[model samples]
Target: MDLTHSAQDEAFRREVRDWLETHLSGDFAGVRGLGGSGREHEAYDERLAWDRHLAAHGWTCIGWPEEYGGRGLNAARQVIFHEEYARADGPGRVNHLGEELLGPTLIAFGTPEQRDRFLPGIRTVEELWCQGYSEPDAGSDLAAVKTRARLEPVSEPGGPRQWVVHGQKVWTSLAHLADWCFAVVRTDPASTRHAGLSYLLIPMHQEGVEVRPIQQLTGTSEFNEVFFDGARTDASMVVGAPGDGWKVAMGTLGYERGVSTIGQQIRFARELDAVVALARHNGTIDDPAVQDRVTRARMGLEVLRLNALRMLTGPASATPGHEVAIGKLLWSTWHRSLGELAMEVAGAASLTAHAPPYELDDFQRLFLFSRADTLYGGSNEIQRNIIAERVLGLPREPKP
Candidate 1:
């Protein structure tokens, strides 16, 4: 909302800038955000260290209350923090599922016991989490999830309610490293697609649960196919309430769409810098067409930041409505286009092992990954349908 930073914000920005200058380097690029990144133990270890350092400095979990080991900053300050971090080329890949999804869910819907138990560890990156939303069949049609959890009453004195779960979850990111996964499991089939579901925190390393990595086209094993033959969890792990899984999962999706992807805008900006540098170094910047494309990419990156901020500031009820769809489509298209331009700018030189740092296979990596952006977080087609029916008030398609 505040387009211009106040003096305090400017000073805070400078403080961040000074720290980054000492910490990061000219080639300080990393896996912009968490994905199926290569297993670099050193990178992971360094990232964990950075998260702890940032958390100690009140820079991690920017939106959380001070009680939860955050700075209690306003959304404006949060934006400034992201902007400053980006400018200094120092963003982190620290525990998105925890900070963005579970942390907020705990803040809004979790009991005090859950919050006190979970929030602090998330800050410390001690308890990692992954989403167990997608199933063998349910992707966009998430309400069609078949993972089943049957509630069992605990017999021991003061023991928790227990749930025995059985189902398969696919595309669960970091399930191998995660201690817990927040999942939507079918509790009652007779209730309906949207009802009779429940959210549960299933332990990953338990005996009945088996996790196999999903080897990505990128040759990295970041996602997994997890099977729960008879995974049992205490009743305390249910997120919201029994049969409230759809609602609780909606909260997660809301976090995913609006805030989870919030880190990408600036990271893309940094990527844009690399692309532009590659173009300039390869003597393509002087080409009028190349310059035009580069400038457009820069503008698109800026627009992405503003759009993501707008989405974050808006209400949960606003959701993935038409306006949100438009933003996403534009972001997805521009993302691919930027990668294309990077390849073009690099030309045959990109084929050389001695290509400039920015001209390396980064664009190729992104190009492959970019193909999936529009498809994930709900397909662009789904977003368009939402826009038509909700934003444009268009008639719905006929039922088959």
Candidate 2:
């Protein structure tokens, strides 16, 4: 794929840069750099308002097709937008689950009715979404999911039908704030493993559903335990045919690492810069070990960027295969190491909270929260399994 920017691409970059510079001032200035991985709880309301502000200006979901209320930008322009957004230190997006992951999945695998019903809300940031993939028993072993969803029979002539869901999902990011959840549940009671699973879109506001926040190592509750007790959505809400959820779910995973990754890499660059700056300020830069680690971090980040570009070289809508696991493994391991490096740079001061009630400084929180970086999304072990068994065409690991 051509990495060179054409005149048009450069012009688009200027447009994104100018727009962010103009709008991310005055009222929006406080939100600049306010929310990210460990800091998502910071200025949330302000950042949400800023998200809606972007949606109103046709800035959200720019890569989506125009008919779906997007700008229908090509991949190059989309990268430019994310790059500029990160460069300007724009606040972390509130609707990434909706806009980046689910939106694309629906576009690729969902029925036309699904698109017509859901795309507008996602485009406008009127609805927020949370992934419902991980469960207490089935985090990386997704096919082992035990959550069950059964279609309710029509009670009377022409009465509305719905699917009743019952199960618990753990580590549901942003579940407390989401209006909807796209989940994988067992639609067939007898079918085992990857078969008989269906991807269902369930509403979060119903009485049958409950959300309990899980406070993390960062002292924040961005993740949650979601309990669905007879929760109902329209019978037609399943993304693909029932018992075909494994495929649709995999498609969503493919979209998980998409164009927004460019912005993420940019954020990582900023974090590395902060670590280096801290090392300098505290004289840790004088340590040969510190200098070497920092240098290695920089190199790993470049490798990350190049790998991301390679992963994204295909059509925007393509469903990536196991090759994408390589990217996940690399970024997660690199980030976790950066967190450790951060604590080292702080010397002994890293051991304590900055204030009462577990207030951690930036590096402390980074160190704490990033410990899960390798665990969530997909575990490092899981990624390696994918790379080995699928990408490298090696034999599968022995199953007990």
Best by lDDT: 2
lDDT of 1 by residue, 283-339 (tens): 889999998988888888878777877765665334333466767777888887877
lDDT of each: 0.74, 0.92
Clashes of 1: 1
Which residue pairs does candidate 1 place in steric collision?
161-235
Candidate 1 deviant stretches above 4 angstroms: 22-42, 154-160, 259-263, 283-292, 312-326, 348-360
Give the per-residue lDDT of model 2 (tens digit) for 1-400: 6789999899889999999999999999999998888888999899999999999998999989887878899888888999999999999999999999999999889999999999999988999999999999999999999999887765864788889999999999999899999999999999999999999999999989999999888889999999999899899999999999999998888888777988999999999999999999999999999999999999999999889888888866668777788888999999999999999999999998899889999889888988999999889999999888887889999988
Provide the TM-score for each candidate, comma-separated.
0.85, 0.98
- Once superposed on the true structure, which residue ranges of model 2 sit more than 4 Å away at CA? 157-159
**TM-score, structure 2 vs. true:** 0.98
Question: RMSD to native for every prediction?
Answer: 4.1, 1.1
